[model samples]
Target: MDWQYENGRIYSTDENGELMCEATFIRKENGEMDIDHTYVNPVLRGQGVAAQMMEVVAEYFRKEQLKTTATCSYANIWLKRHEKLYPDILSEDTSDQAVACKIDGKH
Candidate 1:
């Protein structure tokens, strides 16, 4: 499996070039980026695909010196579990308002 990053999104692809999972980050009004969406193909579930994608997203955020709001439920859970790995990028405000706006097309 290989991970590709492009257009502010990360994609996991198999050797055959089939997509296994994907995660996207959207820039918010406050200049922080949100991990707004993530999907792992049902066939690829439980294979650590989402965890790998989250790692890539976290690394990208650190390298770019950007903050992150984990809106995706999986991402939120991952962040909580890996707080030490991303302390600086984790926002102090954990309110779901930003995520809600993004989902409702209000942001």
Candidate 2:
């Protein structure tokens, strides 16, 4: 399976071009991006497809020096598991329910 990123979403496909998984995000007014949705083809569940998508998004955020907010529960949990890689982006207060990411005007 090949995983690819495009249009603020991560997608996976098999050799036959069948969609296996997708993770979507929205760019917020604050120049932050919020991962809002994720879906894995039922047959592809438990195969780490979603994890791969999350990893890609995380790397993109890091490379762009952008903070990320995860509105999707899965993304939230993923972030919790990988806090060290995003310490500067994660909310320090930890009280706000919304996940917010901020970029330093780098876009």
Candidate 3:
């Protein structure tokens, strides 16, 4: 997937411009980023697309020398799963309660 980056989002769209996947974050007052949303189109689910998206997000943070926490459930879990590879990028306050999927309101 061809991901696109913006001020606070990393996402990809189909040829017709329909959203395929997305992860959104907000910059915190403490200078840490809080990942708040993640979405994958149904057609793209079960294909490891969400994991790929998180990898992109992780790489982006590493490249920018930023720290991050994840309020979005998937992101929170993913970060923990890959902590060894991104030790310095995860904030100490990285734990978050489970949240519904932002795009469809599914848990």
Candidate 4:
């Protein structure tokens, strides 16, 4: 899938030019970014589409040497699952217990 970066979000569209999925981030001071939103079209759920988008976004952060944090539920959950794989790009705030609980589907 092709990804487009605009207005603080990375998104993809379907053949019909419809939005397929997107991940949004807010830039913070000190070279940090908060990934505050992630959405996947219903038909694409459970197909790892969102994960793929986040991976690309994560890579972008790594390339720009930016720190990533998560506030949106999807972003938080994704971070908890993959944070270990991206220690360099992820924010240290992920150590919070709340993120862990969210990863366990408690929130």
Candidate 5:
């Protein structure tokens, strides 16, 4: 699989040019990216590809000194599960409309 970032999305495509996985987000004016969608081709699921894709996006945020918020359920779960790894890049719970994701204290 090959990963590519364009416009405001991160995605991977298969050798035949089929999209295998993707994570999409909205760039908020507050410098926080709101992840709105995350998906992996059924063939690409269960292999941590989604997580890896998100990691790349998170790393970008880290380098750019940005933050991230998740409106997608899958993304929210992943970020909250790996809180410590992204504390600096993950946006804090500020908006009342944001989901209250829980941390498992594993990281």
Candidate 6:
């Protein structure tokens, strides 16, 4: 799927322009990128779309030479799972974000 980029986001939309996948990041004072939210439409779930989005985000970080931490639960988990592939971009500390996420008012 083709992705679109903005200042701190990468996302894709369906033909009708409905958001199909989205990942939003917050830029930290230290130039770290805190991936704060990631979403995949229900229709696209179970298709590895989320992982693909993460890869795109990771590649962006790699290219920009930015450090990454994730406050979004999914992003945090994904970063760890793919740590071996993105060690250079992964932040050394994410404990502060262990309980971070705004989905379903869970934050």
Q: CA lDDT of each candidate? A: 0.78, 0.73, 0.89, 0.78, 0.76, 0.89
User: What would you estimate as the lDDT of candidate 5?
Assistant: 0.76
**lDDT of candidate 3 over 27-101, digit per residue (tens):** 999999988899899999999999999999999999999999887889988999999999989998875534445
| lDDT tens per residue, model 2, 1-107 | 57687888888888888888877777878777777777788997898877877887787778878777776778878888888867766554322546433333222
lDDT of 6 by residue, 59-85 (tens): 999999999899898999998888889
- Candidate 4: the clashing residue pairs are none
Number of clashing pairs per prediction, in order:
0, 1, 0, 0, 0, 0
Ranking by TM-score: 6, 3, 5, 4, 1, 2
Model 4: residues >4 Å from true position, as ranges?
A: 97-107
Cα displacement (Å) at residue 46, model 2 = 1.4
Q: What local lDDT score does residue 64 receive in model 3, on the 0 to 100 scale?
A: 99
Which of 2 and 3 is ahead in TM-score?
3
> Can you give the TM-score per candidate against the true fold?
0.81, 0.77, 0.90, 0.82, 0.82, 0.91
lDDT tens readout by residue for model 4, 22-84 = 887778786678777777889999998988998998888888888888877677777778877
How do the residues 2-85 of candidate 1 rate in per-residue lDDT, one tens digit apiece?
A: 778897788887778877888888888898888878888899889887888788888888998988887777787788889887
Give the clash total for candidate 3. Answer: 0
Which of the predicted structures, 3 or 4, would earn the higher TM-score when compared with the native?
3
Model 6 whole-model lDDT (C-alpha atoms): 0.89
Model 2 TM-score, 2 decimals? 0.77
Winner by TM-score: 6
